[model samples]
Target: MDFFSRQESARRATARMLVYMVVTVLLLFAAVNLVLYGCLWLVGHHALSRSVWWWHQWTPQAILGTFLLVAGGSLLEWFRLRDGGRTVAEMMGAIPVDYATRDLAERQLLNITEEMAIASGLPVPSVHVMKQESGINAFVAGLIPEKTVLVVTRGALDHLNRDELQGVVAHEFSHILNGDTRLNMRLLAALSGILAIGQLGGFLMRSLTGGYDGRQTRNPVTIVWIFGLALWLVGWLGLLQGRLIKAAVSREREILADASGLQFTRNPEGLAGALWKIREQGSWLSGLHAEEISHLCFGESLNMQRWLATHPPIDERIEALYPGYLARMRQRQKNPRPAAPTAPTPPSWNPEGTLGFASTTGRFAAPDKPLFASPSPDEPIPFDGVFSSGGLVGRIGELRMEDLESATWLHRQLPVEVTRALQTGTGAKAVLYALIARFQPMEPARLRALLADRASFASWVEQVGGQMQSLDARFALPVVELCLPRLALSDAGEVTGLLAELNVLAMDNDHLSVFEFALLKRVEQHLRPKPPLMQRHALESRLQPVAVLLHSLLAFSSHDEAAIARHHHQLMSELCPSPPAIPDHGLPPLEALDKALHQLRSLNPDGKRRLLDLCARAVESDGILHIREYELLRVIAGLLDCPVPLLQGVIHE
Candidate 1:
């Protein structure tokens, strides 16, 4: 499905859940009323006549009270989990994976995650390992891409080979891209509310029976006893309904994820093999809260009733991956045969007309030629003005085997020092400082004075500045992206301090260069603990703000006044047909541009697409797409939650 379809699916799932919740609440209301009527009737049996009507015992207040109780409980649980993916990860006892770890397996996991993030054009999610569990399971959790976290079991790392591990990781990434996490979290919250009803019943049963006090209450009518029993039974029924809902939603998504994983690796056997391993070994978790998140796991956490299994059965999943395997297995069972022993082959890197691939060894081989080469100025630019907003959204989390291969190639091509620096907080901070210094060099006297008080930080920056300057422009953003996870390890205060220092250094010359602004903005976007709330605005109402952004972008694209005016006119005609008076003032300051972009972000998805189309027009108006301009466009597209893979491909080509 495309991105738009996935989003629609999520909305539909939410609607379906609401229907289920309403039905559940109604059932609980009836059940509670029945129990209350029975209790009241028995309680008044000795004082009232036998002919007293049963309907007289029923009270609207009782039903209303029960409905309110269930609704309030569910809302409380949902609100508690609003913090999103991290809360779910903690519930599963997942610990963050250390970037500086020396463990080869963990290092491999980090490397694979990095490649996947780059290929998919997303910020790298935090990786967590469920060290306590020895189950071959993994999952992705988060309300959105930026807050997403990937969790895997220790057993998976221990048992799965590199190819199998990559398959599993890719499967989880599919959930992230497909917008499944938000739906999954919603299901979790809804189920939590239902379970609370059951728990309340259990508590009532225990209290009424005097199970906690070791003595029963002497209520001869047995009214309270029947009421407690009814509550307990109804509560379990709610639990059953929740499991069924989870099973229905999770089962279908698992199949889709399996297929998407194959698309990511271009190796069906990789995922099929992981499933086979899970079957042979076990995917059962020994944790206390395992069943609470059974639906979120890579495989079923409990050997639940077939109708309530969160994931489809292993044989069925494997069959979906490799059709006719089950028939072949049955035939083999009918006629037993000895397995043949084959010689093991060493993994070799192969690259033909297709993208490069390493054999099962999982080692990435450097390509014979650069995977991407810069297009010469005379090359025919691949500019297609027809923009499909849905198509672009679909590509947001989409990845092909070729993209993965390219990611591997890019990772290998990065400078060794750059790679090392990304593994530690101190080094990462220095790298950011050096990147800023490259754009805004300070005078010797000022530089000496700035260094006087901060000896170590200044020395590190000076040492890395020259190296960072010599690096290719294409690698600059990716290097900074790679450093983010480690930099994120610092406390919030430390990040604030770093941002302050960067601002000071960038403003040393009293102006923010385009590069400086883009770099700082991108860094701040990721480093902040939470993103600003996304507000929606109508397209017609946002015309002037859109024009301001386009004008600034056009001005930044070229120094030639004619080219700038030409692009501005084109944007105005296309985006603002009525043609507002063009502001004759020079380019807006960085702060104004930042505010304009932030406001533009409030536009709905379709509105954002139009804005991006205008951006594409502005960049290409000069007939030369400079690398800096291309990078700037990419940063903007990413912020807008639109992936411009086609435009990105043109630049890489």
Candidate 2:
């Protein structure tokens, strides 16, 4: 989906959740009111009275009190679950996850993650393993992108091997991508609120039964206390009802996650095999914390009443992914593929600027570069040309200007169908063409050149076409890196950063393999800028020593780590300081910065000052100033902000 559609879906989902909350709250409010009146009528022998005074004196206050109890309960549960999950991770200990320790199984997991993320255009999520649990399971947790976690069971990591694990993690990533994580978290919080009401009712009953202290009650008060006791009993019953509702919500989410995971990975057998192994192993060692997070896992983790199971049966899950999976399983007594290979180690990049530009001369280039020369100096770049030059344009407006005068109109006119097709296409070249076609009416000569150029577009077309026809059709995203040498060849930093962004985007929905990344460097050489020797040197010098230190602190440091780690983080922060991370609390500033970033990500350089003006907006998002969050935003701005000089260069031409 294009960015806006994803946002729209998220908004609609959130709105639905709010409606659910409103209806639930209103029902609870009415129910509490009934309980209050029923007690008053029963104890005082009062006739049914719906007097205004009765509401003012009792019902509203009781409803307000119940709301407080629910809110408090939710607060308690949120902290409890968050802390509990962390403790569980700690107890499991850190399973060694460096590049060196990964065997073929682990390597495959990482590569799949990279490929999906890049393909989907999102940040690469960090990977984690639950080293103890032998059951096949995985869960994603986190409220924000930076804090999100993907945890898999030991069985998933060790027992299933590479392909199966890829299927599992890919499934989890789908949940993260689909905005389900937020919904899942909200569901948990709301359930906590419901349970709190029951707890309050129980507490009142116990208090009445305990008998009031001599100093605390009069005869009349004692009589009222008797009514409280009856209400407490009803409250206890309500708790069970609340629990059932929570479980029902969780059960539906599991099935949805399963289907969505299949949609994302596009490999039914991979997920099916993982499920098969889970059933065969039959070692369901339920984690102590499973009850608290049962909703988040791949399978049923909670030992519910058989009727209250959160997940569909394992067989059902398998069949959904692979029709007649069991029948096929029976036929394949001999292993289908060679014994699963050992996980390969991730290669260490020489952090220095040594890596050469990959060439696209033969097998590696994408098939969709614009065939004709760039727009003539006197003419504006045509929208069609801009679309054809998908890899070239860094900003959205730069590609859209010829179509309309305003960005708003351009946003409205976006061709959703074309974008969708391009996004789902098998080859990057086809995707690139689709993206262009979506934005601008076709230009025959430009399309022809895009399809026919021997030295540039032709090779990419031939390779992508073949790949599309193959049994395992897949887009070669890294092939786009070949164009880096042609467009931003003179600036090594720009080329590296651009390639990294594309690489990250490719793996956004899947894992990016080191092989894919390496192969990209080779392709960029032949089809792009520089002599053969320069391309080779460019690839070799990529992992420079300085770059290694820069990335070491910049990319992975967590919020909690401090001292030297903190200093390195701070230094890295200073290196590219631009703006602060805005909390979700503020509005206008965030809205402006968001608009600016949208333009930048689209590759448009126009009106960048508008982005800088919104820096203050980001700083105030969370209501309170957090230095760390601010620093994070600053880091982002630094990376996306193009210097005035670069903009000036474009203008002068």
Candidate 3:
């Protein structure tokens, strides 16, 4: 499925999961109430004769109390987890991966992660490592797109080669792209209630029997024991259902992620290799919270009944990734003797900068030059082609091997100074300040005041600003993306300071330059908590914001005035058949445009897809793509929550 279909399916699955979760809770309520009714009948509060119904012993108040107890437990878990991926990772004792890390394995993880982020056309999410874990496992976590994070275990890095590790990272990113992180977090919250009930039972059984609390109960120990045993039994039943639900949901997603990994790395053997290692050494973790997080793992984290396993069998996964893979492995194992050599093994992925992908090369084992080209900012690009509008829209939310190469190529093109600057929080904000300063020439004093008042801070911004002197316009988005994780690490005061200064700078000019707009707007989207996810807003009622967005986007295009006007007319006609009267204010200010983008984000997925379709049509009218148009297109798409592929494949043939 494409991005749109996957998004819609995720929404449907979430809805169904909620229903199942609620039904499970209701069943728990019934079981507990029946237990109470039996206890009451034994005490002779009511007769079980035909004159009185058995449910009479289960009072309305008791039913409401049990229901409320289960609901409250679930709600508490949701509250604890509402903060997004960071909260989830912290729960599992994951340490964040710093870009400046000295360890080679850690650095490799960062590089591979950035490559995948570029492929998915999203910001590079925060990466975390479970250093103590020997399991070859990983998972993504987050409630929203901007808050998502990727995590991997130490064993994964140690055991897997570049190809196998890259394949593992690709699988986790597929979770991020497929909206599985959000769904997985929600499932975790839902099951917390069942776990809580079981714990409550354990507590009662211990407390009443002088286990932990060490209290001697002299009155009615027999009744108390019966009640405690009943709660314990019912809680165990609830846990059974919870695990069954988690297993059913997690199994299918694991297979889907493996398939996506194959698409992304274009090396089935890489993922198959990872699975084979898991088969040998196992993927189970010894972390304190491993059981709680098992369903979200890349490999099955727990040994359980086959019917209740969270992931498919390792051999099954290997076979799925490469048909007859297990049998071939057994055949090789049986033949211990040296066999006659036939064909040399192909090299693992090499991120060497190569133009005209696919036709020019097949084997990437050994490249003559450095793995990638380190082009000077002034160096000419070998290709500058148009977006394949008629066909490429489907590339959104999809990552491929070429996309990974493009990501690596883009990473290498950056000057070392800029890459280093992006590693820190303040330096990242300073880099943005530098990019914004480049938008409109400002006097030295004015820029100093707008960027920072403190000499230490202002000097840093100016230093990074110097690095921007040789920067190309095409690199603007990348700089912003690299800044995301760092910016996320910055204090709220720093983020707010950056935003305040940006608005002051933007307002002084009274115009939104294409580069500045994309730069600042993306930063704001990440720092500011997005409005709650809601899809109830109708497209018909949002025509005006749609118009404002279209106008602001076209104004940045490299097309001639006549062509721009013609494309606008065609788009507006298709977008609004009846044509609601909109203001004729040629182009909106930066603030208005920003507002329009946010408003359009709530459009139903299909509505947003059509808007992109019309937007692509407008670009097609120009018959070519320019850096400004490309950035504007991405900015618009990001605001709509629809990510496009990075500037690599589309920028070439």
Backbone clashes in model 3, listed as residue pairs = none
List runs of model 1 lying over 4 Å from the truth.
Answer: 45-61, 206-229, 324-363, 374-394, 439-451, 529-535, 572-576, 583-589, 643-649
Models 1 onward score TM values of: 0.86, 0.47, 0.88
Q: Per-residue alpha-carbon lDDT of model 2 for 1-653, expressed as tens digits?
A: 42223334555665765665666666666666767776666555444454432363477677787778777877876665453233334433425233223244454454455444433333334456667777777777655333355666666766665456656766776666556566666666666676566556556556654345668754565554555664565455454554455555555556656775665555687688778887776435466556556666776665567565656688888988899998878676555755434322222222331111111111112224311123344543222321122212232111121111121121222232212222221233343332222223333354445445344543443333333332110122222321221232134564464346444433443443233322333333322322111111221222222223222223222333344344443433432443122223233332333333323432222222223222322222222323222233333333332211011011101
The better candidate by lDDT, 1 or 2, is 1
Weakest 10 consecutive residues of candidate 3 by summed lDDT: 352-361
Candidate 2 residue-wise lDDT at 292? 52
As for lDDT, the candidate ahead, 1 or 3, is: 3
Worst 10 residues of 1 by lDDT: 341-350
On TM-score, who's better, 1 or 2?
A: 1
Pick the TM-score winner: 3
* Candidate 3 TM-score versus the reference: 0.88
Worst 10 residues of 2 by lDDT: 643-652
How many clashes does the backbone of model 1 have? 0
- Cα lDDT tens digits, model 3, 588-630, are 5556777777778788777777777766665555455556767
